[model samples]
Target: MSVQLRHYFRLLSSTTMKSCRSNKLLANNFIIDFNGFYRNMSTVAEVVRPTDPNLPVEIMDVEEYRRMNGIECFGNSVADPIKTFDTYRWHPNLYRRIKEIGYQTTTPIQAQSLPIVFDKRDIVGIASSGSGKTLSFVLPALMRCMTSKQDLWPRCLILTPSRELTHQIEKVIKSFRFVRSICLYGGVSYEVQEMLLNKANPHIVISTPSRLETIFQKGITKLDNVDYVVVDEADLMLKSGQQSSFAHIMNNLPKKRQTLMFSATWPPSVQKLAEQYLDNYIRVNVSQTQSLSSLTVNKNIEQIVKVVKESEKEDKLLEVMNELVPSVTGFIKTIIFVRSKRTANRLVKFLKKESFPARAFHSSKHQEERDYIIREFRKGVIPILVATDVASRGLDFINVKFVINYDFPSQMEDYIHRIGRTGRYKETGKALTFFTAKNIYHKSNLIELLKETKQTIDKNLIDLTEESEDNIIKDDNNNNNDKDSGYESSGEGNDLDNDEDESSSSEWTSDDESTNKTKKL
Candidate 1:
């Protein structure tokens, strides 16, 4: 071994022997020992760790590779050519809005999707999260509406799977300043949604399927003038949530209207929805390696997974959280997703009792509560949010760096949405998930997805020991996990720390007995 390598081994030995940082011992039994530290100090070049003989090894010291190649941040100005709004030939009002929002250049998805929509062509855009996919459709929709004859009801309709996503899309659309748009979803007053829809007579409207279904049933005239239709998170719609609402809306839409579907992953359901609504649509996929590829993040955070017993999951999560707090000193923001609302609420309660500023979201949170929590989360008042499939789908919050999967989804696609909440908007984020023995069946499908994305799981993290193979069984099961049995194949973190005592933590108190049964917004 080189002298430098010998010195590093000595450092490792002292650290390990002192019992600092690492809670568990190294997997290999051999402890680093300094054999020749003084004489050959200048000769040491590289240090390598002993491999776990049983598991397959993947050597990916990306930082070292980058350094060796003299690659200093390739994604800076040199890699991406910037484009101004004037280059797109946008309307003056829309151009002003885009500039105001600091949108100097069009992202690849936006660049490709904008023109097709502007030309009145039906489109299917497949892009990774945070690729400015929303703006791609929103800009064209608003510009077209603002320039055209203003319809009393909305001329354009955007449908998102969750209330959070509906609100997010609406927020982006509303930035047009000159354009009028309304966001409709459950948990808020029907009168509120109705009044906004009626009084604003918005040129564009974004909503969830549930609320839109109600609007249509209540003789809302807005449905008739909606010449442009957008189905966001069509995969989520097809997977676990209600498809009837979308079907009803499609049945009611004017046959001549243009349609657009955008999603990170297009499973069979999205394809079916596209066939039902989109006509001769042009497809635009911007993900570098398709669905399973994770977007790049700043190298500060490291992602790893732990395989545990299903029954011990809660205990393991608690242990990991305690271990993470001190290691990551700052008040780091985190997002955690559980498979069911019951489990989500339970976890939130546990965190609250542990004195963590955490909240749970699902179909169960009332409109006002959901609204308050999401706003608080965005404002950083609530540092951590525990959620069900609703938060998993398409909610965008870029500052989130740490995400944890308390319960692995029965379907692998949901796993993608969960991790996607972090590592967004060109920022670095870390994700740690707990995969239990029960989830062993999903190993193959998940591995296939990773392979498709030209990526591989960290062998150190995934324990692929089970030999028995069984496919994930599909069921009619939706949100309640009580709705139907089997697997609703459709849709859809790290830690540091050691300051607070676990048993004495404070808990969040709620007085509202009325539950938000199917609240989406």
Candidate 2:
């Protein structure tokens, strides 16, 4: 036997003999002898300790065990934590790829979730956005593939909410280069995706639910061999009109497969979906409270809300842009979110006419146009983008300076997702909201959110309206006083023509509008 191997065997023998004789050697201290052996050997040697005959033996490094024990954990802290990539027996290629990507220390979510995933258990992980949740699952999935034999079909399937998110997961998977993977999403030709699937025969498939369902229905992709399934942005999938598609995909997958669900928030809809789909799953919540809003909402984002008339929103937006112009140096990357595609297109035209290079992204645009807009926006070619809720989810845009709500979102959850586009990766950002009477229904929710995030709430929004049952009399009197006057004006005109002549010049068809609407819940 080689010297290193001989040394390792001798060390193991000595440790085992010492433990048996003393009857006081703890599993924790038994690592000391192996630490020296590990440093001397170039290749990883599996050290198995069969403490129990009924349970499977785990092979881990002594240093890794110590680091994992040092990690802090929350919610169902029964599971062991993994603080670093080196703490577990990861595939060599996967380990090298992780280090290459400059990931040294594990984030709180990664530290806590990796151990549960490695144990081959169904897990529901609740962590904030930009908390490295992607790598938490990616590393475990790759390791599962690496420790097994290669298969002709994908052994892992990762489902995301949007095409952009599918592409993002695909990019992360590709970086490992150990397993072949393909990205499947809608808005692209099915023929191309089919051809790639047949040719690559990837071991991992990252896709959106709708596209994955289409492929599954056609019998082009099989899930019999898929032992690992990851559902990213689980709350969005369950609540955002994609629940049926998600259910269809889950039903087709193998019943014995390991499923992992990651989400920023966990509402009743998500909880119901989890109970239906997962079997005895372990819940790992890194956030202090069960509500994900308290965790995912970035405290660094500077939020400002202006109560403006509906017609003057464009003017107010322009004024805000002008104020930011002096402080911004080269390119001011901003995302302006509107309620409808019509407003997005109109805002784009108005901004362009005022010398701001802008683009519009919504479901109405062709797939290629949307792709181009996203690429150019990322490269700073188009600094301003007016979009609908399509861009509100988990797609990470780099260095977004500001997120402006041209039209306030009807749902409180949507408002969180919209601002989440900026202030990502721990970078400071700003969010400006243009609130009008149309959004008065969300005033209480907005006030609560602002207070939760420690943001300055406007006093005008604090006043209770007729919607509040307790203030019905006061609200009725206020409404009567307003009706008595010709119109209680906020010093802004209701007509779009009052702002500028450009309003008449721009004309759009109904096809250019987004039909997807979100309501307050």
Whose TM-score is greatest here?
2
* TM per candidate: 0.70, 0.76
Give me the overall lDDT of model 2: 0.67
Residue 195 of model 2 has an lDDT of 96
Per-residue accuracy of model 2 over 1-521 as CA lDDT, tens digit each: 65655565565557464556433223322332222111112213334332222334334443354344332233342345544556565566766677788876677778668767876778888765676789888887777778776654788899987777877788888888888889887756678889999999888899888778888999887888998999998776655566777889999888888888887766677778788887778876653322233334666688888876656777888998877843446558999887665667667777778877777776655555556778888998878888877788777799898999887764666777788888777688899987766556667667766776789988766763534332223444554344221111222122111111011211222222243432221
What's model 2's lDDT at 296? Answer: 48
**Residue-pair clashes per candidate, as listed?**
19, 0
**Can you give the lDDT of residue 66 in candidate 1?**
31
Where is model 2 poorest over a 10-residue stretch in terms of lDDT? 496-505
lDDT of 2 at 58: 37
Identify the leading candidate in terms of lDDT.
2
Q: Cα deviation of 518 in candidate 2 (Å)?
A: 29
